[model samples]
Structures are given as C-alpha cells and as structure tokens.
Target: MSTSSHHRPRDLRLDFFRGLGMFIIFVAHVPENSWTLWIPARFGFSDATEIFVFCSGMASAIAFGAAFRRHGWWIGFARTAFRVWQVYWAHIALFMVTVALLLVFDRINPSVEYTERLYVIPFFEDTASAFLGLMTLTYVPNYFDILPMYLVILAMMPFVIALARISEAVALAGIGILWLFATSGYLNLPAEPWSDREWFFNPFAWQLVFFTGFAFMSGWLKPPPVNRWLIGLAIAILVVTVPFAHRWGWQNAEWIFEARDLVWGGLEKTDFGVLRYVHFLALAYVAWVAAGEGGRRLAGGGAWGRFVAITRKVGQQSLAIFLTGMVLAQVMGMVLDLIGRNMLTWALVNLSGFLILIATAYGVAWFKSQPWRKPSAAEASGSRSGAQGRAEPVSRRSELAAGE
Candidate 1:
C-alpha cells in the first residue's frame, strides 16, 4: 500500500457521533433516570446500540480493511482475530466484575432484588453450569449482550472484507438475504441453558447495519449528495413519528394514529425491524444535511471543538470507557435502590457518572500517549539477534499496523 493510503486522516464526524453515542449509552444503561426519558430511543425505533454497532463496523473496516489492502489477507485476518479475542476477554472480565458487584449488593441488602433482575439468579442456583455458560457466551445478561454480538460480527469481518473485495453487490446481497431470514425469525442462535431465549441483538440481522457502515468506509458505497427533498421527507417522517414517542413516556399509552401491521411492523429490536431501520436511515439523512460543513468546521475550535476533542478521545478508546460505564451504571442502580430514586439523585448520579467516564477516557488517551523507554544497547543487540534467528519474516508495516 502507498504511504498516502495509510496516512489518510480520520473523519471527525464519525468520531464526534461515536463519542455522542458513548455518552448516550452510559445514560441509557443507568435505568430510572430522568435523563433516560429524553434519550433518542424514547422518540424513535432505534437506540444507541445502532450507533455503536454501525460506527464499530465503520471503524473496523477502516482499520482492518486498510491492513488487508496494504499487507495481505492473512495479516488482516490476524488483526480481526485479535480484536475478537480482545472483545471476548473484555466481556468475560466485565461479567465477572458485574457478578461480584451484584453479589456484594446482595450481601448488603438481601431483599434488594438485584439477583433475579440482573439475571444472575442462575449463577447462584447453579454455579457450575452458569459459570460455564458465561464462558461459552450463552449466559449473557441484559445490557451485556451487545459485546458478544459485536464479537461475532468482528469474527466474521475478514470474510466480509474478502467478499467485498470480490464484488460489493454480491457481498451486500448475501448480507441482505441473511438479514431477511433473521428478521423472519426462522434463523437465530438459541441460548443453550435458556432454551427458548435467543440472543438479544442478533448478529445475523444486525450485520446489515454493521456492514453498511463497513461498505461506506471501504469506498464500496458512496454517499449520495445531500438532497433538500430527502431532508424534507425525513423531517416529515420524524414529525409523524412524534406520536409514537408517547408510548415511552406513559405505560399503556394509546397511539394517536395507529397504522395497519402491513404498513409498518412493530419495533422488534433483536431483528432490527424494518420500521426501525428506515427510521434510522431517515434520521441519518436529516443529521447529515443539518450538520453539513458547519459540523466539520466546528471541530477546528471553540467550545464545540473542545467537546468534540473529548468525545473523539472517548470514541477512540470506547471499549475501556464502555466497560467502565457499565460497571458504574450498575453501581448507580444499587445506590438508587438503597437510597431511593428521585430527580435529584438521578441528576447527581448521571452527571457524576458522565464526568468519571470522561476522566477515564482522558486517562486512557494519556496512557496511550506516554513515551516508551528505549532499550539498552545490550538489549537492542539481543533483540536483533533474536529477530535474525527467527525463520518467518516479519513485515515492519504489519508491526506498525498492530492496533488501530
């Protein structure tokens, strides 16, 4: 690959939106918050999960696809494999910590009802099987399923990249067919111990959104010029959908204008329902038009620029920040249960949690930026000798491309 290809600058828009999504995820994860009422999910068919998955797909393509194009298929495959391993370990570690937290909470207040709600009751009842299931990715608790789904998608990314290389249309067609089958509920991976249960975010279906981002980043799909009519149409749809947002605010709230099932299927998050997908597309179009060049320019300087910088850092080190957010959210939930839930408590917890998450992101960024110590002359000589002794040749380009 040419140096220019490898040196392409990152898109500020992606980083900004991804950082925004991270904040939204943190808020959404902590339930019973007044802020949760105002999350985009309350007004639309989709939530932060879509943004996270889609952006992740785009990021993966840019990072791994470049490697495949520059080095070789195997190198890219190795990179993808490493990512899957990283996510798998992260998920497991998060699970262990979460379990520990819940156990502690239970000991503090046995009647708090944290066990059954968090879906760790099985872990207490059947420790051996539950522990095994967790390790095998079958005992996924609520809010913990997203990473596993992402893991599956990243694991299959090498093949997706190769297929796109061959023919974008064919690759996308295959993905569409899989998505259609998944949506029809004919195809799904079953949760073993929980026989009737399926993965919360189905990979087969959600891959459509993921690969859509991948295709766009890989240059297989070119974004169309912002059209005024499309923006108007999107705005109109959002206005029409405002009534649907009421369901979130009030329990058993009747729709002001109900439509037939044939016109729009109900929102099914697992399968990425047709209505939700279309709603997301409409939202994306409107956002693109609204942001325009002003959004790009804002990244240069000002209050918005600093905001973007912080978010971009959070987005860059999303995994660590996300894990921290999940654990923190649970802690906040426990605090609320003990003290009681109210507007003041909600505001304090969320505001404090957001600050902590931002600090964690900055910490990761600072750590990453720290300079490494140079090896001593003797150590350098030994390293050179070891490299010479190795049979397989190592590519310096591949070494530089280790992490993205």
Candidate 2:
C-alpha cells in the first residue's frame, strides 16, 4: 500500500485540478450566467465544492502529514494551528470586505436592489449581532462559508494525525462515526444571529470526503486500481442524470421519476449525502486514470503546458486567489445588476474576472520567485546553527495551500 516510491517531487495534477476548481467556482458563483449551465454540476451529482474540498484534504495530508512524520507532534501541531489561524483571518477579512462592498453599492445606487437577498438582509438589519456572529464563525454569508468549514478541518488535523499514528483504521473509524452523526442529524453545529440555521457546508459530514483524500495521499488508504466496469457505470450514471439536470429534458419527461426521487430522497449538498460522495469517488477515479500522467506530461510543453503553469501558480497561492475571487464575484454581481443581465454583460464581467484571477496568480508566482536578499555572513552562520537543532524546511510540495 505504500506510495512513497510513487511520489513525485511535486504533483502538478493537484495544482492543475485545484486551479480548475477555482475557475469553476468563480463561474458558478456569478449570479445568472448562461455559462453556468455547462459547469460539472449540471452534468453530474457533484460539483466544484467536492473537488475543492477533496483536493484540499489531499494537499493538507501532503503538507501536515509530512510535518507530523518528520518534526514530531509539537511542530506539526504548530504548523497546522498556524494554517487554521491564517484561514480564520482570511474568512473574517472576506466577510468584512463583502459587507463593505454591498453597503457601498446600496448607498451609491439607492434604487438598485443589493441587500435584499436572504443572506445579505441579516447584516443590514442587525449589524451588531451579525458582526458578533462573523467574529465567532457563525455568520457565514453565501459563497463565504467554505473557508470557515476548511478552518474547522485544519483545526482537527493534529488530532487526526495523532490518531493515525496509533492506527489508521482507528482514525478512519472515528472520522466515519462523525460523518454519520452529522449526516443523520444526530450532530449539528449551530450558526449565530440565525439560531435556526446551521453551516452551509457541514464540516461534520463533509470531513469524511476530506479525510478520504488525506488518507489516500498520506498512504494510509490506498486507492483501488481503476476498474473498467466501474468507470462505465459512472459514465452511464452521468449520462442518465444529464437529462434531468436540464430544463428541456425535465420539461419533456414528466413520466420519469424526478432525479431527486431516484436516490433515497435525493442527495443533499449540505450533508454530503451517500450518492453525492459516491459520485465524487467515481469521478475522482476516472479523473485519476485519465489525467494522472497526462497532467505531468502537460506540465513539462506547448499550449497545454502553458495552461498547466498558470494553474499551478494559482494553486500554489490558492488562498489569496480564492479570497480575491470571492470579492470580485460580488463586484461583478453589482455590475450585472446595474447594467442589466444580458449575455454581453455576463460575458464582460466573467471574462474580466477570470483574467484578473490569472493575473493575480502570475503576480503571486513572480513574488514568490523573487530573491529578496542573500543572508549576511552572521545571518547565514545563525541559520546554519539553527539547522542543526531543527527539522528541515518543509518542501514546496508539502506546503499546504496558505488558507487550507
């Protein structure tokens, strides 16, 4: 089951897929773009949330798992805790910026409707309570909940790694129990200022998928060989499900059982239902078979290589780019609201937003690449002195996404 021998210096595939998920998220979040019709969610049971969460788990395993192995518990815990802190602040910053943007837009364009949505309405009516909730991780606005969910996951990494050290089976069983509890409504995490509501992405249930990714990447769980039959079945499910996903097909076939009815009362995104999780597993398997090596090759010439480079850069700076996209998406929504929602407006906003993301990625990549200054002789001597007593710096491949 060991995959250490199979590990690459860097998995470009992780970066490429994660960056692609970011793009999908940006497009999908745009209020009413025609382009959204073609995103993965329309064709299958899972969407970018699945991709993002799962990849993040894998990345976390690569990052924090390695630290635990090399630096022992304290250092690993510190690193994981540091990341949780980063994500916590990023979430708060995004919330404040989003609220400011909406308030300013509402003030400037008095006639334009902006804060009337269910999620936005709360902030305007009860600023004090909402602000309190935001500080407490309970007032997550729409499109702003994922980071908080991820923060919870990162906060648990030390415990997960500790349990895995005793026995991988034990760690997985614990994770499974929690997932079941969440899925069955036996466990719930409450949201403040909205006592009746819970987190949109229930970390309790979703942690199973996240831990699955982490375990697989950390060699605690080996991915089964790709099965042709399974692949065919997955493809068949996707094909059969597509018609139900579209307006034309749903309109034409009233006789067929509704897609939601086919699965035990349909898959629920918040709970990460059984069908939804299974679909993502199937999709991930097929994607692995199809792109694992091909992606590596692509990373190495030509147009595809260039594409891979850009995405890898974005993936490397995932936190910054994701936060930027969240803010930009809101701004784009305002523009569309003011100009009217036409194909031209949608195209302009989406295209401009996407380009901004790519540019941000390139900018981060350039910044990380800069050699600010060589250490002075005394500083170099101090560094060498310190190296003898500590673990080596974490490799770039093992560095988790900043906010992950």
Candidate 3:
C-alpha cells in the first residue's frame, strides 16, 4: 500500500494494455491511414482515448495514491504537480516540433498547406493573442487539447485524495457531480476565443473514466468477479455493436449511425457519452479477464512473451512515446499524403511508426535509468568487461516500468 515497499510487483497487463493503446493511438492519429479503419474505435463506441485515460488513471493511482497513503497528502500532490509540469512542457514541445516540421514541409511542397490542415495557421496568423492563448491554454486547438485536459485532472488529484481520506463515497460523489454537469453541457473550459466551443476532452466529463481506474487501483473498488455471465455480456456488447460502428456499415446502412446517436443521446465523444463508457468498460473487462493473474498470458519465457515485454516497455515510457508518436504520426501523414495511400504505403508507414515507438520507449527507458550516475565497483567492473544496461538496480527498473 506504500511506495516505500519498493519491490512491489506490477501487473504487466497495465503496461501491456497501455502500450497497446499507445500503438493504436499512433495509428489513429496519422491523417487518413487505412489501417485506422480497423482500430477499436471503428468496431465499437470507444477508442484508444478511453484506453489511455483509464490506464493512466490506474497508473496515477498506483504511483501517487500509495505515496499519499504512506508519505502524506502534500507529498502526493507535489508528485502529481511535478508530472503535470512535465506533461505541460511535453505539450509545448509537441506543438513546436509539429508546427516547425509542417512549415518546413510546406515550404518544399507549396501545393500542400500542412499547417492549415492541422489548424496551426491561426497561431501564426495572430501570434500575439494566439501565442498568449496557447501559453495560457485559452486557445486549445482540437489536436492539442489532450494535455490541457490531462493536466487539469492531475491538478485535481489532491482534492480526490483528500476526499478519499475523509470518505470514499464523498470522492465518488464529487466525481459523479462533475460528470453530470459536463455531460449535460453545463461545465467545460473554453477552447478558443473566436466564438463558443469547449475543450474536446472535457476534464469534468472524462474524469469519470479516469477515477474509475483510480478507484480500482487504489482499492476503493474491488475487481469485478470473473463470471461466465459477465464475460458473455461483455462479449455481446462488443460483437453486437460492431456493425453500428464499422465504416462499412455506416456507408451501406446509414440508419445504424442514426440509431446509435439516438440510443446514446448522441454518442458524443467530446462529452464522454453513455454508450462509450459502457462499451469501454466491457472491452476493458474482457481484456482484464484474458490477461489473467499477474498478466500470466503476457508474462513467461518465449517469443510471444518477449514481444509482450517489449510492448510493456512502450507503455512504461508512454509519455515520451506518446509525444514522439504524435509528431511522427504527422510526419508519416505527410509522407502518405505525398506518396498517396495504397495498401503497401499504409503497411510500411504503420509498421515503421510502431518500430520508431518501440525504439523511443527503449531510448527513454535508458535515459530514465540515469546512466550518468556513478556505478558500484561490481557494476564498474562489469562495464569494463562489456556489460550494458542490465546492471541497473532492480528497484529503479521496477519503479520506471510501473509508472511513466
């Protein structure tokens, strides 16, 4: 229950699923990638966004919540604030790199307006106000809204933790109230100054998903029992809803989309619509059941196990990979746009993106391992004798792998 217990084992499934979500998110972000047609979003009401927010909340609970319990409230809030600061800088970096690259490409290919495509032009057009808004987060573009929403939630973690200290019901009630206000369209931060629009991922609405994961991981809620009936219902929810979500069905049978909108009161992703929540929980349950205890399905010695471990690495250093993935996705989108999207181009871009993400994960892991630090005599001898990264202390490795 305490971060002082440094050797605590992590459930590999968390990293595995979160890493898988990162990869899927990469696929989803690239503009017009054919592979995107088959992503979870296309098959159900929810997508990798759910996977990300939910898993991130669980990771936060594991990393921050336990610390709060052991070290006290202020320390836990400090850790969360530090993470928010890191993510804030990462967001700025993501935007800068993306805009710079797009401008460079646009200069070369005068026929294409890449900046306009992603809505980066407004910043250049009105640098004074737009830059101020960007810095203040008053003009959050659609593509760059994720971090703003994320940091807002991180800023609220202390309140939730403080509430849980008093009573779990009070914390849950707080979360529910926000969800109600936001989903009802009464609560949200303004995204841009031009007219009237709210943040794409409304923190108030999305906190429901985040806190659900937090509650489970913090032991506020028990894991659902694995029963045949539960599994059946989850499967049915996934299977029966596919046609309504699939691109082919939307093209061939338009009513499915309309029906979906009607059934969920609009299925609006911005507000974290009802059907999306249910569908994501069902999918998450099925995945949780399949991973089994201690991620037995993903842990073991073999080819598949090794691949699973690699994916978990990607998940462990998710923030770096996510930033890299977003920028790389835009690069791949430019490549695809120039070359045109055929089956071969799609496969190459998607596979190369995945490899780059994997490499990013390992690279970030090496950096987080803090190679600049001095080593023990045994480590020094091993280093002189051709040893590499494997010499890092077990606890440090566990800590890095458990949280990003």
Candidate 4:
C-alpha cells in the first residue's frame, strides 16, 4: 500500500554479486579461452546468466514496483514500456557496433574469421533481410540474443505487477504458467530468418528466474531462512551436479558424461530447464546467507573493502559494462588468436578484459552522476551542497538495463 516500502537504501549485495557475474560472463564468452573451463557454469547446472537475470529481476522490483504502487498501473506500464524502448535500442546498437568491429578486424586479418566465427557473416550476406530482422528483433544471432530476451522479459513487468495485486499465489501462478508453456516449447521467439530455430535464451522461460528475484525483492515471497541443514543440502546439490553439467578430472571417462543426460535429464540452458532453475535458487540461497543481507559482511575500510567497492561499481553500471564486455570478449578472442593462445597470453587477455569492464563501470557512474551540468557557485567552490541538491534521482535505474 505504500511506495515508501519500495524505496530503500541501495542493496550492496545485489551490486557485488552482479559485478562478479559480469566478469564471469566476459571470461566465458571468449572463444577457446581455457579460463572458461573453471567458471561456475562448468561446475554447476547454472552459470553467470542466472546471476544476471535474477539480480535484474530483483532490481526491476525496485525500479518498476514503486511506480505501480504510487502512480497507477497504467503509468507503471508506461514506465516499463519506456525501459523496453531503451533496451530495444541498446540491443540494436550493440549488434551494429559489434558487427562493425568484427568487419574491421576481419578486414585487417581475414584468416581470423571474426565475423564468421560468430555467424555474423549471414548478416552481411543477406544485409537487407538481416537488417530488417535486426531492427525488428527477429534475426538474433546467439551472441546478440541476451538483450532481446531481456527486452521481452522486461515488457512483461506490467503483467507481473498487476498480478501481484490480486494475490501472491496468483502472481506466482501467472509466472509458473508462462514458464511451463515456454518450457514445453509451445512458446518462443524466432532467432533467425531461414528456419524455425528459437532464440538462444527464451524470454518466457527465463522470466521464471527473473521474477523469482522480483518476488523476493518486492516482498511477495518471504526470504528463505538460513539454516544448517539447508546449507548442507545446498552444498550437496552443487557438488553432486558438477559431474552432470561438466566433465572435469574425468578425461578417460567420456561415457560418464554421456550417461549424465539420462540420469539427471533435461537441464538445458536454453529453456531455463527445471534443474537449472532449482540449481540457481540453491546457489543464490547459499550466497544470500554468506553475504548476510545487504552484504554487510563485505564491508570494511581496508583493501578488501576497496575490491568490494570496485565490484559494486561494476554492478551499478551493468548495462554499459555488459555491452562493453560482450564486444571486448570477441576482441579478446581475436587477440588471443593473433598472439597465439597460451597460458601467459590467456592470463593477460582475461585480466585486460576485467580492467576494461571496471573502467566502463566507473565511466558509466561518472555519466550517471551527471557531472556535465554546471554546479551551483557554492558547490563549484567546494561548499556543502544542500540535501535537496545532493539527493539521488528517484528515477534512477534499478539494475542491468535497470541500473539505479
């Protein structure tokens, strides 16, 4: 009943973990990068994608929920629509920019096959239809699919907010039904022009993770309590699933890997499969207990805190960070090929990408801080700005494309 509840201090936990996921995503995206062999996804049913989506959902609850509570459902829908507009354009821009980068790099060194590597050559071969699909969001290459899925999922916010009004069960039912239909393959968006292939990350199915985070953050679902037994169970689930999701330390046992599909079954990353969903919830719960709400355990005035501060900054500017990282991942892969992939070069490429991601975060923060407008004479001269002048914008984004 109160918008005030939706308004609260920034949650550092969301920012810190999201920042971690951003880095993991960069490492994973780079082709043939050995570092990817160690990322969380290699060891579990879910990976950085879950982190990105769930945190986004939590962030959206803050970003959009207040509008629904304070203004009206129509106004809330307007706000959500405006965000979808922004994300749609961001998707277009990222694809265009990336395609241009790939072409430039390929022109310099065709042997690397940069464009063909990502299947972007198809876009060039059929530029007219491809451009049409890009503009309409129908020709989503796998590398470019995440934002489109996010855009579609974000557009569903009005319905989620509306259903929450009737009852929490109704809200959950609405979410569950959508996810089920999508999982059954009855619902999906076309990702390419020539075939019936669906988007790499189907928004309807993915919305389950997105809205679960939304539900908890919006108080529609009670937060899970930390318990010793639950902790043990979560740990067991994570360890037991490693063999199924990945084949590590088992170089001679290829059959064990093949047998996994039958034993555990259907944990497809594409559909937001049931096991992926459960696995991520368990991972999130353990992280929640460890971070101790708002990530209070992560606070201090020393070097550890400094590292945490940098991570939170990255999380805060995720939209920009993600766009930059995605492009850099491709570039880094090309660079690795150019220099010859090795332990030394691999380390350098990975570290350099992280640095760039960090820089993007800080740069975005500087812009979002809006330093361009001239300061008042007193503020310009280093006097304390009045509280009203210093207050954060109420319209600040919540996370991902939902940055706050």
- How far off is residue 247 in model 4, in Å? 1.8
Q: Candidate 3, residues 1-404: lDDT per residue as tens digits? A: 11222322344778889999999999999998989888899999899999999988988987887778888988888888899898888888888888999998898777889999898788888888888778888889998988888889888889998898789989999998889889998988888877588788899889889999888887777788889999999999999888888878867786876786577654688889888999999999999888775556777888998899899999998888889999999999989988889999999999999999999999989988897796888888988766345555666788899997
- TM-score for candidate 1: 0.86
lDDT (10s digit) by residue, model 4, range 226-270: 789999999889988877677652344677666665644358777
RMSD of each predicted structure: 9.1, 9.6, 8.3, 9.2
Global lDDT of each model? 0.78, 0.79, 0.86, 0.85
Give Cα distance to truth, residue 313, candidate 4, Å.
0.2
lDDT winner among the candidates? 3
Candidate 3, residue 39: the lDDT equals 89
Model 1, residue pairs in steric clash: none
| Model 1 local distance difference test score | 0.78
**What TM-score quantifies how close candidate 4 is to the native fold?**
0.90
Q: Of the pair 2 and 4, which is ahead by lDDT?
A: 4
Please identify model 2 stretches exceeding 4 Å from their true place. 247-252, 255-259, 262-266, 292-297, 374-404
Worst 10 contiguous positions by lDDT, candidate 1: 1-10
Alpha-carbon deviation at 312 in model 3, angstroms: 0.2
Compute each candidate's TM-score over C-alphas. Answer: 0.86, 0.86, 0.90, 0.90
